[model samples]
Each structure stands twice: as structure tokens, then as C-alpha cells.
Target: MVVRDAKPDEQTVTSLAAAAGTAPSMFNAQPWRFRYLRDAATFQLRAALDRTLPHTDPHGRALHLGCGAALFNLRVAAAHAGWEPVVTLLPDPYDPRLLATVRLAPADAPDQELARLHPTLTRRHSSRVPFRDELVPEPVRARLRAAAEREGGQLHFPSIWHVRAILELVRDAEGRDRATPARAEERERWTRTPEEARTATDGVVEQVLGPYGGYHSIPVRDLAGRHSAFEQGDPTPFEEEPQLALLGTAEDRPADWLRAGQAMERVLLLCTEYGLSTGLTTQVLEWSELRWPVRDPESGMGQVQMVIRLGYGPPVPGSPRRPVGQILEID
Candidate 1:
């Protein structure tokens, strides 16, 4: 059997890291790190304990999900680079921080489908602005479900009363956060001011924060609400009718969260490929009470991991990523 070289060159490593680094995280915390073993052509994904948002992601499930998204991007990057990526999740039983490992082997026939998604990596960003209230077609939704299912997760589109329940739960979560000073502090910690955003490497900045409601009741998380201490955005009208999808997995475990994260990213990327804008909110899911009811009583979707908004909308700037040098170690 032919084998790949023991070590990939600097350019290849940087390119792959750049793609993987584009994955979305809770509040853009980017709670993940990477280590490439040059001698073995393996990339190890580890949790960035320093970057964890403890209050919102108390159990590190969101962190694992973000890391899984990064892992998915890494796989796509590898396939585009003519390498076969063999991945193992939770390879180490004792080391909880070590999330996954990917071994890259040279591929004579690379994954064409994954390679097609290479361009979408840069194009896929969370659209925080208002999307047209038009419903996504059933066929398009089916394709999105296929994307999620391929990654060991499920996606369901909920309209009518289901949408009302979700929106109310999000408002409830918002009210709960407002009542508690500590919960409000979570948004403050990850939100960036206009000045900070100009040079900041991470966090939800002013431009993408969208704005507070004026005439609409969308469920977009307002990260910059506490302007007395941080920058706050002006009020803007959002779509009255938002198309929503619930992405979930069969089980609720670290591994399941990771799978949901991958499925989430895959669905978003596929959405981008179809020229659709997407945004995601986990606000209700952070609170257990609101989280349980997020499931559709009409259908069995396991544990609802993420609430995703999809539609046609104007593009927003992608959040900045930490320099590859900061998150990647080659040795």
C-alpha cells in the first residue's frame, strides 16, 4: 500500500487550519485547539479550556459541538487537498480534553462531494440580520435534512404552533437572563464594542449584532444589550415570520453533541451552497426547562441540539478567527 509522507508542509498545514478555524462557536469563543503530529500525519483536536463559556455552556457540550464543527471543516479541507481523512471521536477515554483525532492519508480518489463544499467554507457565516419571511421549499429542506442525517443527526422544520413555542421560549430565556445579573454577564463577556471589534480577534462584534426589536419578534440573541457597560445596537425591524429548523441527535452525550455540531455545520454549509442565509440560536437550550419543550410533540426528533433560522437575506461580514498560529501546533 502506498503511504503519504510522514509530514505535511507548512502551506498545507496552514490552509487546513485556516479552513477548520472558520467553524462557529458559542458567542464566537472558538473553544478549540489543534495539534498536528508531523511524524504521523495526524491532527489532534483538543478542547480549549481557557476559552470555555462556563455559564452558558456549563457542561462543555457547546464547546464539544464547536470542536466537532471544526473537525468537519478539517475533513472537508483534507478531501479538497487530495487527502483521505480517517476520524475517531473521543479516542482517549481518560483525557476528557482530547476530543478527536484525524489521520490523513494520501487519497488516489478524493471525496468529490466534500471537495465541492470547500468554497462554501468561506461563504458560510451566521446571518444575524433579518431574512425574508419566505418559507424554504420542501425539496430544499429535504436536502438540508439529508446533510444533517449524513453526519449522524436529524433536522426538522417546525411551523405554526411549533414556531410560536420556540419564539416564546427564547423570549422567556431572554427575560430570565435579564432578571439575573449573572446571566446578562454572559453576553457582556463575549460581546465586543465598536472599538474592540476593529482589532479584536474574537467575539460577537457590533456590526453583526444586528439590533434590538422595533416591529418584529425574531429570536436573534441580542449580545450587545447592556450598553451602559458595553456597546449597544440600535433597534431594527426583523422578519415577522422566521423559518426555523431544529437540529438534534438520538442521544445527549459529549459524542452526540459533537455529532450535532458537525451536522449543524454541514446543514449550514449546504444552505450556503444553495445561496441561503442562515443563523443559529441556542438561547432556549441553555435553560433545561425551555430546552425540553423545544422538541416537536408532533414528531420524535430525539434531543433538540440547535435552533437554526434559514432564509434569503443580505450577507453579513464573517466573524474574525484567531490566527492559525495561535490555535495550531505542528510538531
Candidate 2:
């Protein structure tokens, strides 16, 4: 591969990082770092351990998926910036921590399709609010499923019974984790107070937490109410039934997690592109007991990595991101 010094405009760099910022994470915890090599027109992704949500993501599978989503964003940005992103996932297996090293290769040109997704990068957020009861047509879901498949994953739209089953798993997992002293301590450390300046890196804050309500179908682990120190939004009953889909992979491995993350982002981006809102729940997948059993009996997938809820609703308030300076290092 060709390697040489390259320079992009200020707007390009800012926009590129902005795209990466849109990547979804466990509880909106964007725990990933980006290193751009200006000379080589490449972006290197690494898992930022300090930002990790250990209480929720113990094995780093979710961590890798979050980084993978950011990596996918960088690729889309590269393509939109008129270059082909030649990615080497886990380029140095001996240095297993290196999530990906992406080199941008010259391409014919970028088209509208590539440039189109750039806006959605920042617009995409995990919407937890109840969706309008309106159903997402089969054709729209088919398009989304195809989008996931393009990135080596499949999206399974769950039926009513399946949705209820997965919902119970989420509730069980949340209750089990929340009851722990160690997990509660971690939650306190990351959750912020209103007096504090909005942090670029941390857990879900008041603004990002959508309309508050008792845990219902997509059981939200009560982050604020449990603390007893904070007040929550007015209770809105879980009246709307959301369109739920299972984001699954055929294999269960570190590399597969990375691919699943990319697929998750692609699906989310497509949703944004289609003017649909989405909320992501991995509580069931995070708990080992619920993961394998939650997989659709017919899909024959090895694991369910993420449960995505999508429909029409208010957009989730954008969460803060660590400044590029804080997340990057120069070699």
C-alpha cells in the first residue's frame, strides 16, 4: 500500500471526527479514541479504557463494538472525503489492543450516497422515548435488514412474543446488575450533576436521557432514580410499542464483535437517513445467561449482540464527546 504525507482541510478533519463522534455506545458511553496520521491520510482507532463502562461492559465485547462503530464512521468519512478506506482490523494481532488502522486510498470520486451519510453521523443518537404507534412498513425494514447484511450482520425483526421474551431478559439483567454494590459505585462515578460543566467524556446525563418513565418493554436501567439525589423527567407511560429488531452475528469472536459494531452503526445511519429514530439495548446481550438463548430459533445465528428499537419519535438529545485533542496522540 502507498504511504506518504497528506494534508486535508480543517473542515475535512473536523467533519471526519464529527462523524466518528456519532458512533453509539453502551449507555451512550463513547469509549473510543482516534489518531489521525496526517502524513498517511489514515485514522487509527483504539479503545479508551478510561471511558469504558465496566459495570455494563465487562468483557470489552461492547467496547470493541463501540470502537468498531467509530471505525465505520471514519471509513464513511474517508469515502465521502474522496478516498477509499483500506482498513486492516486489528492490524497487529500481537498488539491486540489496536482495534483498526485505516489507510485512505485514492478513488475515482465520492458520490452523493457517500456524502449523504455525513450529516447523520452527528444526528444519530439512542432514542429511549416511546415511539409513535405507527408501524414501520415491511419495505423499510427490508432495506434496513439489507443494510445490516452489507456489513456482515443480520437484523431480525422480532414478533410480539419474541419482543416480550427479550424484554424480560433485559429486565432480569438490569435488576441483577443494579442490585450490586460494585456496579452502583461505578454508576455514581460516571453519572454527573447539573452543577458540573458538561463533560466531553462520561455516562448518560440528564439531557441525553429521553422521556422518563417506569421501565417497560425496553427496560431502562434506572440510572437517575436509583441515586435518589437527582430528579427525573415527568413520567410518560410506555404507551407506544416500538419496532424492535435483533442485530445478530453468525460468529462470536473479538473480530465478530468489531464487525457487529460496524453493522450496528450502518443500520443506525440508514435509520437516520430514512428519518427514523432508534434506541439500542444490549442489557440482554451483556448478561451471558440471556445472550445465546435470546437468538431467534430460526435465524441460526450464534449470538445476539444488540437489540435495536426503531420508530418515529423525538430525536435523542446529542451527548457530549471528548475533544479531538483529548482523544488523539501524535507519533
List runs of model 1 lying over 4 Å from the truth.
Answer: 1-7, 214-216, 226-234
Find the candidate with the highest lDDT and give its number: 1
In model 1, pairs of residues that clash are: none
Residues forming the 10-long window of minimal summed lDDT in candidate 1: 226-235
Q: How close is candidate 1 to the true structure, as a TM-score?
A: 0.95
Residue range 125-155, candidate 1, lDDT tens digits: 9988888878788999999999999999999
Task: Pick out the ten consecutive residues of candidate 2 with the lowest summed lDDT.
Answer: 225-234
**Candidate 2: TM-score?**
0.90
Computed on alpha carbons, the lDDT of every model, listed in order, comes to 0.87, 0.76
Q: List, residue by residue over 1-331, the lDDT tens digit for candidate 2.
A: 4334445665676677767766877766678877778777677888888777766778899898898898888878877787777888888878777899877676666545656787788888877677788888899999899988988998999777877887778778777767777777776666667755254365677776655565554555566544222354346676455568999888888899999999999889989999898888877777777787778797767688888888888766876676666666544
